[model samples]
Each structure stands twice: as structure tokens, then as C-alpha cells.
Target: MHSFSIILLPLLSLLPSTISQTSGTFNAMTFNVAGLPAILNDNGVPGDKTANTARIGQLFTQYNISLIQVQEDFNYHATLYANDKHPYRTATSGGVPFGSGLNTLSNYEFTDFARVKWNTCSNIDSADCLTPKGFTFMRVKFAEGVSIDAYNLHADAGTTAADTTARASNLRQVSDYITAHSINNSVLVFGDSNSRYTRTGDIPSIFSTANGMKDAWLELVRGGVAPQAGTDALLCDNPSPNTTCETVDKMWYRGSSAVELQAQKFQYAGNMFLQENGDVLSDHDPVLVDFAWTKV
Candidate 1:
């Protein structure tokens, strides 16, 4: 019922391709569901969170998203869970005011599921302290003997000094955890990282500088070039399908000694999540990244 099961995937996918022992593919996504209670919902964001969340969950199966990380998955989580068919999903950590608002859904099996709270908090430009904001981690298996450490997080949001300090600590916490627990293991980190490389005072480089992970959007979409110095300049106000645009929703990945991983595509998924009235489902559009793996 609440997130513990052993659903088997296709036998063919479970085994590496015999023709090319290394060739395999999978896709991962991160979306902020904006599942705040009606009273907390941003008036600017149309449609009902409860209604949209169900559809959001349904879309994953429709798209065959291999794995998903959802942030702001607070209130209305049941509806999201009810509609999503993914056999591997994280149990909600209660709703906002009590939860960290982070969760993951996967088609493949995973283990070592864990949650970690940020060591610091602030409510300068945003109300980060109103809930137990933090990150979640797990080891997802792509196939037999093939597993990668995966993570989901919602960091402190704001631009004030207090906000930057807290966000810095948040990234450091994730980086530290990867260094300690996932060293030499393949890693796939995704979620709403509020911090932006273009924004001043953001430690967005910690993923690469500390964990040796590469940003999918930066490397595959931007040709490995960072955004020009600016204040998160490309934050889209509406659902945008352009993957080159800068955003807080991010994905970082790295391969291990036995398997090599490369980003095949980075997509900003939008059209599939729109409501009848053409309004987007959530405040943040999902980041979907396709990956190809081969034995090293």
C-alpha cells in the first residue's frame, strides 16, 4: 500500500543486451508538483493542486518515465500516489508544516531509501523554515548488478544573505553525503535546487567540484557552457519547452568503474502536463533527461 513492493520489470530489460552487452537506456525526471494546500497555493498558479497532481502522476506512466523525483509534494500527496502506478515510490513524509516535501517514483527497483534534513534554515525571501526542508536518497538498480545512487532535494529558496548562506549549506550537505556514502558509485541527483550558477552567492558548482557529477542540461543542452553572469536570468514565467533555458530544477550524473553513463537528451516537459484551459499543472516544469549506459 504505502511504498514497499517488488514489481519485476521486463525480463529483456532486466538483462543487458546480448548483442552489445553495454547498450541500455533510461530516463529520469524532476518536477515540483506545487502540492500546497488550497490556502497556500499561489493564486497566480491556476488549476487545483489536488486535481493537477493526479494528472501529473498519470503522465509519468503515459510517458514511460523510468524514474521521477518530485518536490513540493506535500499536501494532496495521496491523490498523486493514487494515480501514479510506479511500483517503487517513496512514502510521503507527511504534508507541509510537518514534511520535507520530497519524494521519488521509479520503475526499476531501489534500496537504502533515506532522508536527510538540511543543517540550517532561513525565511528571509521565502518561508523555508515553515517546513522540515531536506533531501532524499536511494540506490536505484537499472539491471542485475547495476545500481546507481539517486537523490532528490528541495533546498532553501530566497536571495537574501541568510537565504544564500542556508542554500550553500544545503548543497554542501548533499555533496558531503555523496562523498561519504556514494563514492565510486554511479550517481543521479535531481530536484529543485533553488541555487543557480548564474545567481551570485550560489554554490551550484559543488555538485561538480565536490561530487564529480556533471549537469545534464549544462553538458548536453548548453554544450558544457554555464549561463552568463546574471541573476537566474532565464526563469520562465510559464510552461516552457526549451531545455536550454536556465532553471532551478536540475539533474547531475556520474558513472562508476563498471558502467559508463552519458546524457543523451535533456528535455523540459510541458505539453503533456497542461490542463484543458491551457494552464500548466505546476509552477515548475519537469526536467526529463535521457541516459545511455554501457559497460566500461
Candidate 2:
């Protein structure tokens, strides 16, 4: 089990609130749990891949995560992957051959859920187009009749140029849709973005642009003098460990609510199989964040 702690500081200029009352603070996590399709046959370790499903469930239960976003999935097959104790509703996109998919799980009763497919390319050089993938958007009602949007996204990955195009286009489609039909101003986007801020690309652009939205991690680092998660919570450091780096997985938020980010973390313990004698859990580590929403 991995543990994370966060220290919050007051913002000099507080942003305006959009909700009447925050009601309560909640935690959200994004993890690409290496799709546990029914057909996968684990070579060994911890009673094969099938046996590890329970451990996955236990992790979720331990975190008390209100919302979860994951990538790489097979609709019917993946449904059986989760334990019965934490039943959830999921939405899948993308096409066969390419495993790009999205999965969202929420503990709260979801008022509405749907998948929004954008666009993608199978190969940047090749003319073949790939299918886009995304997850369900839960309309969470806050105080003052305000609402927040929760979602997930998995963009096509590859070289900088290729990945950039796919991330931007797909993000634009989703952002446009949300801005059009969202019940409230607040929106939380999370999942495998596949592009980083230092890297030249659109994944960060689509979210950080003046159009609306801000990366939750970047927001946390704002005006903070302490060593925070943003500087240390690099999820995929196992493949090539270097003074803690950043990668695709990310979280974003929208709306004019003075949000005081309480905590943000990366969970990489028993799951950091590379360092744990190959007890491989998933390719990407989970990112979690806690926030306090102020109501207008």
C-alpha cells in the first residue's frame, strides 16, 4: 500500500466561487490499469493475472476514491475484472486492434453517463485513421444548483508530432461538447493524456488554453514554496527512472469555483513491479487529487 500526504496554503488572490456551497470535498484518481480482458493469460506471479483482480479491488476500496478513470479496456470482458464490492458503470470507445479505450467508475449515484468519441489516426505516416476513445461523464450536483463534469480520455500515442495532433483534436472535440452541454461550469478531466508540458504538443494546449480548463497538478504547484507532488508524482518512472519525470497521465478542471486543492499524489508501491521483482500491476501509476470547492 502506498501513502501520500499533502499540505495546502492560502492563495493570495482567491478565485470566485461558482457553487452556492461546496457541500463536501472528494478525492479522484486516474489509472490506466492495463486492461484485464478475459483472454489474458498471465505467465506466473501471484496466481496469474486472474488472481490479481482482487488486489485491484482492494486498492480501490482502500483509497475511498469517489471517481476513477482508466484506460485500455474491453467492454464486456473488462466489466468482470472489478470485484462485486465496488460495482460501477463504465463506457468504452476506440476500435479493435488498437487497445485505446477509456473506463470511468464513480461511487456516487450517476445521474447521467455517456461516451464521446472524437477522432484519431492509426498511424501518423499512414493515411489509415484510428478510432477515438473516451469515458462516461457524470453530472455531479454541488450546492447552489451548480454541477461538475467528470470524465476520462486516452489519446493516440507515438512520436511527438503524431501524438500532438491526436491529443489536440480529440481534446478539442470533447472540450467543445462539454462547453456546449455541461449542466454547470465545473469540469474535471482525467486519464492518459500521453503528452507533457515540457514536450511540444497539444495535450497540454487544449486544456490550458484560454478557452477554459487548467491542469490540476500545475494548479497545485502555483505559489507553493514546499516540495509538492507536482515535482515528485511522475507516474511512469519504472521504465526509465530519472530524477522523477512526467508522462501522459494527467488531471484537469474547469469552471469558476475557488478550488483549494487539498492533495495530489502518485501511487507506486506493490504496483511498481519493475522495482518489486516484476510483480507487474500496470504500466502507469495512479494519480489522485483532493479538492475543496467553494460555493458562490
Candidate 3:
């Protein structure tokens, strides 16, 4: 009996630690809150920024969503998700203004935040032949040296070849930023991208080629291989009844190696910044994903 006990104890000791090195979960939301007054007026959506903002606060309370990456306008939308107890830290790309486009929010204190402007169309150049920087990247510090990145973006509608090209350029640039920096073990990029999967360009290319980055929606929802979907269960409006509008708002994660990604389901919470009326607060819908990190 003693010999059997000795062998069992050794096997148990060999098992990996169940306690996460940096345990605890974080919820992230990406909403395209189109300006303020427009959202409030029934002319836009049933729930204006004010009402939706209140809803957002309530959501934050209910879900305990800490990391929020909001597109459209960071400065203006920041007001919608503010509370004394649940204050948020923010970062925006310069010159974006109240409605200039692109912004991110976070419940964690920002250790450092920087803007990586993508190439964009210019007023000086021919409208069809210009490229502009796209989106803003922010890094937030959590307890115990753990940190993650949130990118807020609104890519140009890929209605034209020029717009598509610009978006591709911006997506690549964001990847460059990630590749250049030494991000901690965990990372996430979320926002409203006017483009869909297999559309060709930035995100698709990155997910296909970038070793570390992978699409959350595709992995968790489409693939059904992860747990994060529980927090992002809401579906975007399918304008075309015959077609399933694959998600445009999404989240991506960095794998253990620049060549391999380790993604799993956390939870899926759909459209956090939504109004009661059918009308959408913004032209696009918001998506939320929660992640649990364990240091290896």
C-alpha cells in the first residue's frame, strides 16, 4: 500500500499548476457608437448615446466588463461609459476629434498607450489613389505584470479598390506595431471593421499569415472550438436575408508562438451598447468577448 501511495503522489506532483500565473478574467466590448445627439434622437436609434451609455454602465456592472474598445469617437463616447466607481481609462489617435473616428476604452489603468496611424486617403491626392493610417492601439496593465492590447478601428468602407487598399495597408501596419513591440503573454485586438472575412486585405491576411494573431469569431463561433463565445453570443444584423453576415466587429489573440495560436472559449456577450428599439445605435453592431489568461 505504501509503495502504491508513493507512485500516485509523484504522478500528482508532475501535473501542471491549475492556478493561473495571472489568473482572473477580463471582458472587452467594441461598439461603434455613432456620435451623440444622433443616437439619442429617435431619428437615429431608440437608445441614444445617453440611454445606451446608461445601458453600457449597467452592462459593465452586470458582466464586469473591464476592457472596452469603442470605435467612432473616443472623446465623446467616453462620456457614455463613465462612472465614479467604474471609471475608464482611454487613448485615441491624434486629430480624430469628437467624430473623426477610432477610439478605445479600458477599465484597467493604461500602463502605456500609443497611436499607430495607418496610411489613408488624402484631400490633396486623387481620392482614388490615397492611403491613410487606420485605427489606434492601446496597452493596459493589469495586476501582476500582466497586460493586453486593444485596438479601436473603423476601416474605410471597402466600396472601392482604393478603400480596400488603404484598409489592407492599415491592417498590415497594426501587425507591424505588434511584431515590433514586446507585448506580454496575452493580447487582444477588437473593433468595428467595415470589411468581412475572406474579403481580402488586412485582417484576413494577418490571420492567415501572421503567426501569433488569430480571429476570435472564426475560432470560437465559426469553428466552435473555444469557450470565449459565451460572452459574445449576439449576432449582427443580416441585411441580406439569404446571406449570413459574418461578423465584422471581432477580436483577435496572440498565440504562444508567433507561429501558433492557443485560443479557447471564454464567453460571448452580444451588442452591449444596444438600444431597446429595433434601430441600431450605430450603423454597425457591438461585440463583446471575455478571456481568461493563465501564465505559462
Candidate 4:
């Protein structure tokens, strides 16, 4: 009887932990597709719209991406691609006219979707004025009753002080929006920040510290190798002939204590996504992050 009681107690203790373990995992990706006409006019790397759209579709299968955030998709190329390849049930494109080039694609159905254009933008670069650039917010369900607020953003691009300030403002807008609207404080933000983690006063640092969000890449270094601040992982348009490799694309998220989120893997999906002639899929390398949510 004593031996039977001991064994029964041990098995009972394991039931709670096993039942509370993570139910599933999902993968997310953020890429600046450079589909806007301005970027294409600058260089012909990605080539024709039809071919670029096809390659983008193939990447969804190659990476098994569950959620995607894309910037510079002003041409509606992302919308067409998502419809043809991915099984995304819900999607939202940035506003029209002076709409932001941001777009969010998700496997789960979206309960709510919205976009906010930055009040301030880069005055120095004429390209920045071409279209309104901002962030898109979406609510997606991952499990039976689990959902998260997802944000896709594209900040001002340029080296000038105005660009830096505009980028900071964009981060502030996103942070404030999530704080006020996010359900359960579970939020995921990803896109082309045009800011670097290595920079002292960058938008990434500001958003994380001020909003209680964590950078997925820094939290989970790929291959167990710690990345060098700026140069280790570069997601720029052109990798070759570039001395300083900067990480402009990023992913960040926040989850309540009851449900903690952890990044399982983080990497740049560049080599695999390329044309037969070796031309890249997009100007910027698509960044992938595999993460799981578990009960604490």
C-alpha cells in the first residue's frame, strides 16, 4: 500500500505540468519587398513584378510562415501573392491615396484591423513623401481561445536627423496604440524599422524599454551563436560590397506573465530565396522568427 501511494502521487504531480505545456508553435516573417515603383526605378535586382510575386509566394511555403508583415508593398503585389499561395484567412493592406505601404498577412482570421500614418515624415528625401508610411495593427487568433495583436510598421528612411526623429515618432505611435488597445497585453510588432539595435539612441531600444517589449532575435540567438550588435546579421537591400552590415528589419513582442512567449529560432532567409540567375527575391532579406507561447 505504501509503494502504491508513492507512485500514484508522483504521477499525479506530472499531469498539471503536462496539460499546461505549449499547445503549438508558429513562425513569423517580416520583409521589405521593395515593390514600390520608386525602389524599382532605382535598381532592377528583383526584376519584373510577375516573377517577384511568384518567388515571394514560394517563400511562404519554404519558410512555413504563419504570419507575415511586409513593407513597400504599395503595388498590391503582396495582396495578390497572399491570395494565390498562402492559406491566410485574413489580411489588411495599408490605406489608399497617401496610404502607408504596410501590409499584414495572417493564417488566422483577423478580428480587427487598422492603420495609422505617421504625423511626421522625412522632409529631405523626396521618396519618403511619395506615399504615406506608417503602421498596421491586426488581431489574430492562434489557438482555440488565444489571440494576439500584431503590428506591421515602416519608418522613415534616410540618414538625416529628420528621418531619425520621424522613426522615433513612428515607434511612439505604435507603442501608444498597443498600450491602449492590445488585448491581454499580448502584442507582436515587426517590419522595416530603419533602425539598428547597435545604435545607442535607436527606435528599437526606445520601443523595447518604453513599451515592455523584447526583441525576438536578441532573446533567442540563432544556432546558439550570439550576434554581433550591428554587423553580424544584416538585412539590407544589397549585401555584397557593403562594409557595414546593418539590421534594419526586426521583430518584437510582449506577453503577460500567465502566458509567456519565447523565440525558438531567428535567422535571415536570404540564400534560399533567389532567382535562377542568383538575383535576390527582394532588396532586403526576409527575417524569420519561430516562437511558442506556453502557460507559465
Q: Write the per-residue lDDT of candidate 2 for residues 15-128, one digit (tens) a residue.
A: 344324555677777876655343542223334344454556556666557777767554332432455244564544433445345666666555677776655554664322
TM-score of every candidate relative to the true structure: 0.91, 0.69, 0.69, 0.79
Checking candidate 2 for backbone clashes, the offending pairs are 19-295, 19-296, 122-130, 194-248
List, residue by residue over 1-296, the lDDT tens digit for candidate 4. Answer: 99999999999988875663355788888888766654334335646765776677666666667998888776656444654455663344533345576766667677778878888787685357667788888878776546778889888787677777777787888888877887465788999988785554455765567778788766765432334453425544453333234478888888875566777777777665677778876778777788888755
Better of 1 and 3 by TM-score: 1
Regions of candidate 1 where Cα sits further than 4 Å from its true position: 1-21
Error of 3 at 218 (Å): 1.0
Clash count for candidate 2 is 4
Candidate ranking under lDDT, highest first, comes to 1, 4, 2, 3
- Alpha-carbon local distance difference test for all models: 0.86, 0.57, 0.54, 0.71
- Cα lDDT tens digits, model 1, 83-106, are 989989988999979998899989
Q: For candidate 3, what is the TM-score?
A: 0.69
Better of 3 and 4 by lDDT: 4
